[model samples]
Target chain A: MSWTMTRKALWDLRWTTFWYALGLALYTLLIAFVYPTFREQSAQFEEIVRNYPEALLRAFGIEPGQGLSSSFGAFMHAEAYGFVWPLVAAIFVIMSGAAAVAQEVERGTAELWLSVPESRPRLLAGKLVALLVGMLAVVGVSVLSLLVAAPLVDAELPADAAAQLGVVLLDFLIAVAGISVLFSSIFSERGKAAALAAAVVLAMYLAWVIAGLSERFEWLRYLSIFTAYRPREALEGSSVSWAGLLALLAIGLGSMLASLAIFRRRDILV
Target chain B: MDSLPIQVNGLTRFYGKTRGVDDLAFTVERGEIFGFLGPNGAGKTTTIRLLMGLIQPTRGSARIFGLDCWRDATAVKSHVGYVPGDARLYEAMTGAQFLDFLAGFRPGIDPARRRMLVERFDVDLSRTIKHLSKGNRQKLALVQAFMHDPPLLILDEPSSGLDPLMQRELLTFLREEQARGKTIFLSSHLLYEVEQVADRVGIIRDGRLVAVATIEELKRQRTRRMEVAFSMPIDLAQLASVDGVQVLQVREGGRWVELGVSDGLPVLLRRLSELPVVDLVYAPPDLDSVFMGYYQRQEAITGERAR
Candidate 1:
């Protein structure tokens, strides 16, 4: 299989991928710029986080006792715009991956594709590579915007902040792509596959937040991808844990392998 | 004929308890046009998928050019071209880009041949496939299948969405390809289309093959229709006594008799000549009727045995 051919296949779905990346970048900027100015005197942000510290903060990754100017900026960039926004951006990436195979089967295009002189695994691998590249492009653009925006906003830029953000985004990308591939194999509808991926991501995110807010739920930390990823610790210039990274890699690879096994055994509906 | 382009032996595929193909066996000799005739749910698509190695068979095996279709799928794929029954294309890509994407996979395809097929099929390469009409999409499929000029072409309902003119053009194209010594395996429900191109046909129903023969042989062994009009009344029982003649209906003051003659049409015609025949119409058996008879026979066999 030619890598150039795989790249060409990626180019076919590039338009939708571009729009999704652009939307994610714009959403990040909006939170970084607009959300802060609006919260200059409002109590809504405080009140929302007070009652549901575990739910609200975990839902949006907002932390309390972080001052308005500095910690608030951190909360916006580190929490909301950092992991939450990428998670949102990853929804599109996952959607693209799910659409790559299941959509073809659903739309009856797999028949046309398989009729050509291409092996089943090679054809499937090409689509998987295309989807992975599309998601990586989105993450690349997000990192570029964050690097450019940090200084102009007068916020303290940690020495390794940009690198730490890159790591977090990479982990999320692999997790999303893997889960998407898994769902794509099982479901014929694009919407259902995407929804299942989102649900899984959200569940993992919530588990991590609970582990962070209370000591009693510390055991649950193992269940969440967030526990394995700590951008704040990384930004403080500490070494990121290898165990969590390995765990994440294992999950991603395991999901992808499961997908491959199922796809090989199951018939193409189209 | 050094090697068969495609061969199958007792191939069976099942989804749970529902059998898609069962004990199916056939062979396509090199440079021959073989037609697979069947109705919907007749295992045509399943057999094609198994041959393409898109799915594995539950039992038996399929071979392409002497290579196992499933085990050596990559090698087999490199030498054959296929057109699926439902020709679906990538909606996001333009026709030109889709063709380009497929062409990139085959290193041996001739660029000149690809261009010629594209032109002959009249597929607009500039437009996105999502926007193309059904006929145009099918044309795009044809261009992809024939562009490579592989040794074997396996097509399932290649003319389903084509108009009459395009269908004729496709027949001409297939004949030309056959002349060039390319084996063709095509499956379709259109009897007339199959009759025009196929040297031999295999009729399948409910995952089983009911009949397989050359076009001429199938029609000859089936039945022929003869309607005779006489200037005067003729005894119907006398016409019925003719060998191979089965009376269907008698009408018009007993002046006309419609008889179905399975074979020995000469004997029936000679017997009719002595009955003061004024006008006569003799017609060979229609392929459609013969094709239907296979299905009816299958239903009767299954239905009666069940009791």
Candidate 2:
């Protein structure tokens, strides 16, 4: 693959990556700073959490016994990794993927791009690799922040669990990013592609939430990509869920291939 | 492989029922500046897009150095540099960054070459594209297309926002490129620019190639309007003797005769000089009038066939 577009994508994303890393780091520190207060009132917090029903506790990705002050991994999941990381990371990937092709077309830059010697597949492959690299950076910062900051607040953070969960989150992000790119290829405008991808992500999250609420909605989980990720399980285990990772990677790769086929055939009319 | 830089045959594209270009056919010889001219929506951009492989032809093919434009577009692009009609570079990037990004793809381009073009265009590299004026942005677009120096340059309305000085500079540069054996496919509605350097021009109208003529041939084919004023009143027969000259109106009692000269201008001028002559006014045919004449001829032929 020609590294031309890959370098451009990385260069274009440098500022975005830096700011996001700093923001997520600050967010992690905020979580760490509040840990002590939760620990000081651990008994009261646990008692109050126990009063809630099992269904409600499961919906929040918290075990009945494991409440606010239980452990750094469980608390981290309930606070940042479970909701915030996925949400922010989805926004980043969705924006990146939508901007990859559709935004260029909409803005008329793709005319200059397509006129060059580089093949369409090579250009797109470069963008895909760049997104994956950005994901690694985001995931790395989130884990490192938790590992270094929690200790400063007199709380012990399991580095291995945080790293393992980061890996699992990265895997899930790849799947979402692939679909986002596919949507970008289908639409002529970036805003429409981003909106559609965000709606799909929201739908999957809702499906997973509904599944968590009751047994009658259990089948929805299988249909949702959120079912592919279980941060509580990923953090609790010694190793990542390899089967789930492999399945998500496959879906991501398949969607990427489809995107290539569609983008290659699509006319750059603007 | 064909030695010609471009060869288009029976190319047609339609947007639903509306024509983009219909049965367009032409070729650009190596080292020649071929001016592709048409009024807006007459399919100039569409035909260029077809040649660039940015869009597919609905009917036929455009080949560059023998490579099919659509099927082997990537390979075809390797030999071409392009400036889009309505240029929109990355609005977020500075001029330097945009140049670097494009240069990264074309490894053969040297740093000195880009610097030379930047100086030639007189654009600041530090400022973002959105901050630049429209003419400056067009200059940046020109720099990028010319910096790589591909064998063929396909420019669609390249002089859209340029002032007169820059326009002259561009025409001079095109001549220099032609001297170096680079083939240029210049598409525009501006007759002055094309008339300056085009070795030949192809006129497209209603998505069809109406005429392909050298500068000399086009000038010869266009009707010249002549006005003559005699020392005294003369009869219509005095101006009507020349077979090629038709009296439009016998103004001032035939002293000032408005005549349309379609052929043998030398004969008409010789005949006019022999008159009791006072003053004469002649209007040389501009490209616009030439184009209108061709369209009117087509309409007349169509009208006859309809009858």
Clashes of each: 0, 0
CA error at residue B284 for candidate 2, angstroms = 8.2
Show pairs that collide, candidate 2.
none
Error of 2 at A17 (Å): 1.9
Expressed as tens digits, the lDDT of each residue in A135-239 for candidate 2 is 889878877888787778876657677777787888888988988999998898999999999999889888887887778999998777777777766555456
Report the C-alpha displacement of residue B6, candidate 1, in angstroms: 1.1
True contacts kept of each: 0.65, 0.90
The C-alpha stretches of model 2 lying farther than 4 A from their native spots are A50-69, B223-287, B299-307
Encode model 1's per-residue lDDT on B183-247: one tens digit a residue. 99989887778889999998888898778889897665565567889998888888788765678
B-chain TM-score of model 1:
0.81
Best-matching candidate per TM-score: 2
Per-candidate TM-scores read 0.86, 0.88
lDDT of 2 by residue, B1-307 (tens): 4567999999999887988999988999999999998888889999999999988888988999999898999998889989999899988899999998888888888778788889987889999998999899999999999998888999999998999899999999999999998999999997767888999999887798989999777666666677888988876675677765668777776677788776767777777677787988887555556764565567669999999
Question: Please, what is the whole-model Cα lDDT of each candidate in the order they appear?
Answer: 0.76, 0.83
User: Which ten residues in a row are the worst by lDDT in model 2 chain A?
Assistant: A61-70
TM-score of 2: 0.88
For every candidate in turn, the CA RMSD to the true structure comes to: 4.3, 4.0
